[model samples]
Target chain A: MEASTSRLERDYRRVLRLLPAGYRRQWGDDMVGALLDAEQSAAAASAADEGPERQAEERDIALLQRPPLREVAGVAALAVRLHLASPSTAGATAAARLRGDAVRRVALVGLLAAAGPALLSAVTGLYWPVPPELEALGHTRVDALASALLALVAVAAFALFVTGRHRTASVLAVFAVVPDLRHPLETLASAWRVSPGTLLGAACWLLVLLAPLVALLAWRSDAPRPSRRWLLALPVVAALGWVPWLLWRATGALVAPDAAGSLALGAAACAVVALRRSDASWMRTAAVLAAVGGLGSLGQLSLLGYPPGLERDLGWTALGTVLLAAAVGVVAGVTGRRWSAQAAPTAVTAPDRSASDASA
Target chain B: MALTEPAVLVLTALVGETRHGYALIAGVEELSEGRTRLSVGTLYGLLDRLSSEGLIALDREERHQGRTRRYYRLTDDGAAALEAEAQRLAHLARAASARLRTARAV
Candidate 1:
């Protein structure tokens, strides 16, 4: 009985080891005691009800030197709960006031950058000689309406982003990505006979859709709102994004699908600015998001046999974003102390105390 | 703050008197009619959060048979909060009963 009890104790400790060191130090022995107490009571009840043979079998199973999967899962859930719980440290406090900061400037810039594709698509989709089947939805009219909606959503996102409503802008941006996301996916999936060009186009479109979403996530609710003077850049964005790009792209045989990459570039640039600021922990998160996005897009691109033009187009612009993301990611990783140690939430210089330090 | 079911159960477990971790777990199981069983890690995490939020306080500690035992009880604030939650549940129950009575009459 003593040997079985010791073996069970070892197994319980092994399971309890899943908790953070600080937490274990505070309540480890007490917790073990509680567990043993419960187990002993359960054993007593089972012994009373069941036969001796069942009790011996149960003791053998319990002493088998293994913690149950339920116990392991419970510990994992506890870890998650511990991670999500707010720390007592002041450094980890939420920054809700960044709502009215320079994040708006970046979001506005991204909106303007994104506006180009819609304008280009709307205009060029008009003059381009699409096949009879391509014109099924009244050709240019339906195309124009879709572009207008995309541009509208982008503008609305910019407005909300600048006005200190990051979450609302994020939601709007998510809606905006739907059309972009659907277009390429549908184009690629429309037929059993898929072409290399269509695959590249789909990848490109997917990248475009993901850029704004990643940007909005990076900027999030923590970014400061933009300055009013920065609002003057709207006219430039309008002219460059909508007017000229549309005219230029529409006039060509090939449509320049550049807006999503441009938006991602803008997003990465914003992340850089966020990282340089004094209150930049959230900015660090933004940088990491951009890095993950860049890597993910690259992974998607790697899976496809991209055409030569697309290979060149994606390699430079998309890869440029990745490089920028890497730069920020490396800096954030190297310099950030709180990000790593926050999992085991305790002061770095805190003196170790025994569990006997508890107050009644 | 709106208490989760587990938080409510923990509060209920401590209502009678200060209880150590094992006793509290047993009390919660008994009170909840054996429907709820909190693991040690989960219970401690909840207790930490509750203590941090000032809903519960450490009452006493004792060493029994080479094992350390820490006891906890609800604070005044916790008692008041629990009372408020009980009233809210009662109100909801009364409303449900009224609806059932109306249905039966129809």
Candidate 2:
């Protein structure tokens, strides 16, 4: 019985080490004592319910039991919360807040970028003039209907996300990506025989669709609600594309906006936000935006090496702008980190009002 | 700030007396009618947050069965917060019951 108890205590202590070093230092022994106490009480209750012959045997087995999975999961959740929360010094707290802000903006910008093209496409399909030959196809109506519905779903997801209904928005955003996944899924399925260019194109396209969804994970219960002003960007971007498309249709003198162009516009928006804000957090956000845009640009590479035309020119231009933006973002992020580190000591001596008000 | 369910139960447990971690856990379980079982990790996290917010404070520590048990008590702030939360819940509960009774009569 003594040996079993010691083993159980040792195992519990091992799991407790998952917490932050400072936290473990303060609360480790107390937590271990509580766990043991709970175990003992639980064993006693179970023993009371058992017959005399079974009680002693049950007690011995219970003493030797390891920490339950739920307890371990609870500890892990606490560890993640503390590490992410980081209530160390005022400077550290500010840096954490900045990172949170950047992530939230990235999510908003990515979703807005996605929604722009989708809404444009849906509008074009449902309301734009179609050629007689194209209109004659029996399946065109069905395809247009499906496309419009998908676009509406995408817009709804973005709307919900900005309005603070994140859980539902996330689900809808994932649902919105199902159609986009088909081409990539097909490409991946034929991995054994697919060409490198096609495979890379599919993978990059998948990343473009996925980036916003991944960024949306930052919108935890504690995150501040996004402003509704961002919704205005969607209509503006959609209208910007219509001018070029209308010119192309009427005069054949202008290039119509494509997916790559939309991505470039999104990257430019991210760069603008990054440049406008002189803070380290915004710089880091710019870096994340650059990465997402870079993937979209790189995907455009598949359009190159096949023909010497507008597609190739557009690809090269997209790739260049993304690279330039990425370089600026990365340099700014590094400089911001150093500045935050230098300011940390001064911040340590000050009170952390933000820390006290941090969401539990 | 609105109290979370666990925070409310912990504050309720510490009401009128100081209690150790195990006692708080047991008290929470009993108060919740075995519906909510707080793990030690979660309890400590809440305690840490509450202590920082001035809602609770460390009362004392004692050696019991070769283990050091730290007892915590609700502060004035904590009691006030609990009272406010209780009133809010009671108001909602009363509204719910009144509606239910009206529905049954109809």
TM-score of chain B of each: 0.94, 0.95
How well does each candidate superpose onto the true structure, as a TM-score?
0.59, 0.76
Candidate that scores best on lDDT = 2
lDDT of 1 at A51: 79
Per-residue lDDT of A1-360 in model 1, one digit per residue for the tens? 134356666777777676556566667778777776666566655676687777766655545445556556766656443332222311121221122122333345556565544444444555656658867856665665665656667666656666677678778877876765777778678746777755765765676566445445335322345555544555555555453346547753222325544544454655566556533544544553454445544533442355656455545555555565566566655545444344333342112222212232
| Cα misplacement distance, residue A143 of candidate 2 (Å) | 2.6
Ten contiguous residues minimizing lDDT sum, candidate 2 chain A: A345-354
lDDT of 2 by residue, A1-360 (tens): 134346668888889788666567666778888887787677767878677667666655665889888778878866655544433311123444555567767777777777877788888878866656877875477777777878988888888988889899989888988888899889989998998877887887787777777777667666667788878887887777677668657865444434434544565566556556655555666666666667666766655564766776666656674675567556666665775575453322113222342322
Q: What is the DockQ of each candidate?
A: 0.32, 0.41
Question: lDDT tens digits, residues B40-85, model 2?
Answer: 8888877877877778877788887666788888887788899999
